[model samples]
Target: MRTPAQNAHLALLLEVAGTPKPGNVDRHRDLEDLRFEHFLAGAVGAQRGLEQAANGGAVGPAFERSVEGMAAQGGGNTQFGALLLLVPLVRAAADDLSQPVVEAICEDTTVADAAGFYRAFDHVDVFVGEPPAEMEPLDVRRGSDAVPALEERGLTLLDIMEQSVPGDDVAREWVRGFERSFVAAERLAEADGPLTERAAAVFLSLLAERPDTLVATRSGEAVAQEVTERAAELVERNALETDRKIVERFADELVERGVNPGTTADITAAGLFIALERGAITV
Candidate 1:
C-alpha cells in the first residue's frame, strides 16, 4: 500500500496529468511561465514534507518544506493552495479521515504554524487579490515581516485562516472543515472512466458549482459566474462531441481572457488526494 505522503505525490501527478482541465495546468495545458514538468518536479519534491505531515509532524514546518520544494522547481505558487489542504488532510488520514479528527488537527495549529505559513510566501509569486493599501503587518505579502506580528498577537494559523475565510477559498476550507473538498471527493469516488478522466470531470463539476474564487479575484465575480455557468452547461451536454467542442473552446477563451479557475483546480487536487488515500483510485 502506498503511504499517505506517497498518495499525495501520486495525486499531484494525476492532477497535473489529467488533461484539458480547462484553463488550469494539465498535461495538455501550459501557462507562459509554468509547465507540466515544473509541476511534476514540484509534486515529487513535496512528498517528503507531505509524508512528514502524515507521520504526526507539525503543520507549519510541513508547509515550510513543501513550499520550499515547490519554489525550487516551479519558482511560483503552482500548488500552494493545494498544499494547504493536503497538509491537514494527510495528517487526518493518518488517524482517521473524518471531520472531528481533521477539525482537531486544524484547531490545534499554533502561532508557529502561522509564522511558517508566512515564511512559505518568501519563495513564490502567488497570484492573488491585492491587499489593502494600508496593510496589516500580518498581510501575507509582507512575508517574514509578518511573523513578528503573529508572535506578538499569538495568532495561530487557524486563527489567521478564520480571518481570511471570506476572501480566500483555501482558508475557508480550513475554517469550514474542508466541506467543499469532502464534497468533491465524494463526486470523485462515484466518477466513471479512467482515473484521469474522472479527475477532469470532478474539476469541471466543481468549476460549474461555484464561481472559482481565483477567477473571481482576477476577473471579478461577474466574469467568474459567467464562466461557471458555461461550465455547468457543458456538464449537462448529452453528446461527447459537443462537450469536447465546448470544453476545448472554453479552454482557449479562458486562457485568452486570463481567467484561470485555479481554486477549482486546487479543490480537485484535494479530492484526488483523498481518493488516493482511501484507495478509491490507485496508481
Candidate 2:
C-alpha cells in the first residue's frame, strides 16, 4: 500500500507527465521559463513536506515546507496551489478520505496556518490578482508582511481562502469542501485507459468546464473564456481520444501565446491525489 505522501508525490509526477496539457509543462511540452525536468525535480523535492502532512502536521506549515522544497529546484512555483490543496487532503487521507473529513481539516486551520501560507509566497513567484481595496492590507503579495493584519483580523487559512474564493478557483475549492477536486476524482474513476492519459483527458474536461483563473490573470477574462470555448469544442468532438493532433495543436497555440491554464493544472493535481487516496487511481 502506498502512503498518502507517496501518492501525493506521484500525483505531481503524473500531472506533469500527462502530455499536451495545453500551455502547461508536461512530458511533451514546456513553457519558455518552465521545463519538464523542473517539474520532475519539484515532485522529488516536495516529498519531505508531503510526508509531514501525511504524518499529521499542520496544513499551513506542511504547505510552506512543501513550497520551500518545491522551489529548491530551478522551476519557480511548480506546485504551490497544488500543495495548498494536497496538504489538507493528505492530512484528511491520514484519517479518512471524504469531503467532510477534508472540510474539517481545512476549517480547523489556525491564524498561524494563515501566517505560514503567507510565508510560502516568500519562496517563489506566484502570479495572483490584485486584492480588493478593502483587502489590500491582507494581499498575498505582501507575504509575511501581511501577518500582522491577518492576526488582527483573526483570519485563519480557511478564512483567507474564503476571502479569495470569489477570484481564485483554487481558493474556491478550499472553502467549498474541495468540491471540484472530488468531482474530478469521480471523472477520473469513470474514465478509461492509462492513468496518465486519463489525467490529460480530465485536464481538457476541466479547462472546457471553466475558464482558468490563471489565464484570466495573465491574459484577460476575454482570453480565458475564449480558451475555454476552444477546449469545449475539442472535447465535444472527442479529440483527446480520436484526434490527438487537434488537441496538441491547441496546446501548441497556447504555448506560443504564453497563456498557461495553470489553475486548471493545479486542480488536476489535487484531483489525482484524491483519486489515489480513494483507490480510484492506483500506481
Candidate 3:
C-alpha cells in the first residue's frame, strides 16, 4: 500500500496535471505566479504532514504543517484546499474508506483544528467570506487573532464547518458525508482516458453542478452563476470537447475574468484522492 502522503501528493499532481480545468490553472495554463510547478512542489512538500495525519495526528496542525511545508518550498499555498480534503480522507483510510470512519474523524475535530486552519491562512491567501454573524471577531480572514474566540466558544472544526455549509462548498462536503467527492469519483470512473483527463472531466462536471463558493466569495454570485451556466451549457450539449477551440476560449476567458472555480477544483482533488484510496486508480 502506498503511504497516505504519497497518495495525497499524487492526487494533487493528478488534479493539477488535468488540463483545461475551467477558470483554474493546469499544465497548459498559468495564473500569474501560481504555476503548475508550485502546486507539484506543494503536494510533495506536504507529504510528511499528511503522513502524520494518517498516523492519527491532529488534523488542524497537520494541515498547518502541510501548508507551512508548501511555503517553505517556495510554493505559495497552492495545495491548501487539496490538503484540507485529503488529510482527513487519508486518516480515515488508515482504518478504511467507509463513511463511518471518515465521519467519525470529522466529528472528533477540536478547537485546535479550527485554530490550525486559521493559522494556515496566515501562511497563504484564500478568499473567504465573513464569519457567522453570531460569532463576532471569529473571521477566518483574521488569521490567528480569531483563535481566542474560537477557543472561547470551544467550537470544533466540524461545528465551524456546519455553520458555513450554506456558503462553503468544502464545508458542505465535510458535513454531508462527502457526497460530491464520492460522486465525482464515480464520474471519474465512468469517464475513460488518461487519469489526468478523467480528473479534468470530473472537474468540469462539478463546475456544471454548482456555483463555486470560492468564486462567489472572491468575485460575486453573478460571476459564479455565469460560470455555472457556461459549464452547464457545455456539459448539456456534450460540446465541452467536440469543439476544442471553444472550450479553450472559455478557459481563457475565465482566467482573464479572474473567476476561479476553486471549490470545484478542490473537490476534484478530493475525488482523485478517494479514487486512489479505494483502489479505483493506481499510483
Candidate 4:
C-alpha cells in the first residue's frame, strides 16, 4: 500500500495529467506563464513536505516547506492552494481520514503554524485578495513581515483560514469541514474509466457546482458565474461522455480569456488524495 504522502504526490501529478480541465494547466493545455513541466517539478519538490505531514509533523512548518519546495521551480505559484488543502488532510490521514479528525487537526494548529503559513508567501506570489481595513497589518501579501501581527493576535493557522473564507474557496474548506473535497472524492471513486478521465469529469462537475474563487479574484464575479454556467451546460449535455470537442472548445475560450478555475483544480487535488487514501483509486 502506498503511504499518504506518496498518494498525495501522485494526486498532484494525476491532477495535472488530467486533460482539458478548462483554463487549467493540464496535460493538453498550458497557460502562458505556467507549464506542465513546472507542475511536475513542484510535485517532486513537495515530496519532502508531504512526507513531513505524513510523519505527523507540524502543519505550519510542513506547509511552509511544501510551498518553499514547490516554488523552487521557475513557476511562480503552481499549487499553493492545493498544498494548503493537502497538508491537513495528509496529517489527518496519518491517523483517521474522517471529517472530525481533519477538523481536530486544523483546530490543533498553533500560532507558530500561522507564522509558517505567512512565511510561505515569501517563497512565491500567490494571488490573494486584500485584507479588510482593520486587518491590513496582517495581510498575507505582507509575507513574513506579518508574522509579528499574527503572533500578537495569537492567531492559529485555522484562525487565518477562517478569516480567509469569504474570498478563498480553499480556506473555506478548512472552516467548513472540507465538504466539497470529500464529495468530489466520492464522485471520483464511483466514476468510470481511467483516473485522468474521472478527474476531468469531477473537475467539470466541481466547476459547474460553484464559481471558482480564483476565477472571481482574477476576472470578476460575472465572469466566474459565466464560467460556472458554461460548465453546468456542458455537464447537462453530457459532453465529457458524448462530445469532448465541445469541452475542449470551452477550455480554449477560457484560456483565451486568461481565466483559470484554479480553486476548483486545488479541491480536485485534495479529493484525489482522499480517494487514493481510501483505496477508492488504486495505482
RMSD of each: 1.6, 0.9, 1.5, 0.7
Q: What is the TM-score of each candidate against the true structure?
A: 0.95, 0.98, 0.95, 0.99
Model 1 lDDT tens row, 1-283: 8888888888888888876688877878788877888899888878888978999889988987888887778436788899989999999999988778888999999999999989988978777777666446778887888899889999999998898767688888999888888888888889877888878888888888888888888889899889999888888783223557768778877876778888888889999988878877665
Model 4: per-residue lDDT, tens digit, 111-148?
99999999999999988876789999999999999999
Lowest lDDT 10-residue stretch of candidate 4:
123-132
**Candidate 2 accuracy as TM-score:** 0.98
Off by over 4 Å in 3: 73-75
Model 3, residue 119: what's the lDDT? 87
Worst 10 residues of 2 by lDDT: 73-82
* Per-residue lDDT of model 2, residues 31-60, tens digit only: 887998899989998999999999999999
Compared with the true structure, all predictions reach lDDT values of 0.84, 0.92, 0.84, 0.94
Candidate 4 segments whose C-alpha is farther than 4 A from its true place: none
Query: Alpha carbon lDDT of residue 134, candidate 1?
Result: 48
Model 3 residue 12 distance off true place after TM-score fit, in angstroms: 0.4
Kindly list the per-residue Cα lDDT of model 3 for residues 1-283, writing each as its tens digit: 7876678778888999997898888979998877888887787788888888888888899888888787655546687777888888888888888667888889999999999988888987777776668766778878899899889899888998898878888989889888888898878878887898888778988999899999998998998898999988888876655875777788889988888888999999999988887878764
Highest-lDDT candidate: 4
Q: How many pairs in model 4 have backbone atoms within 3 A of each other, for residues 3 or more apart or on separate chains, i.e. clashes?
A: 0
TM-score of 4: 0.99
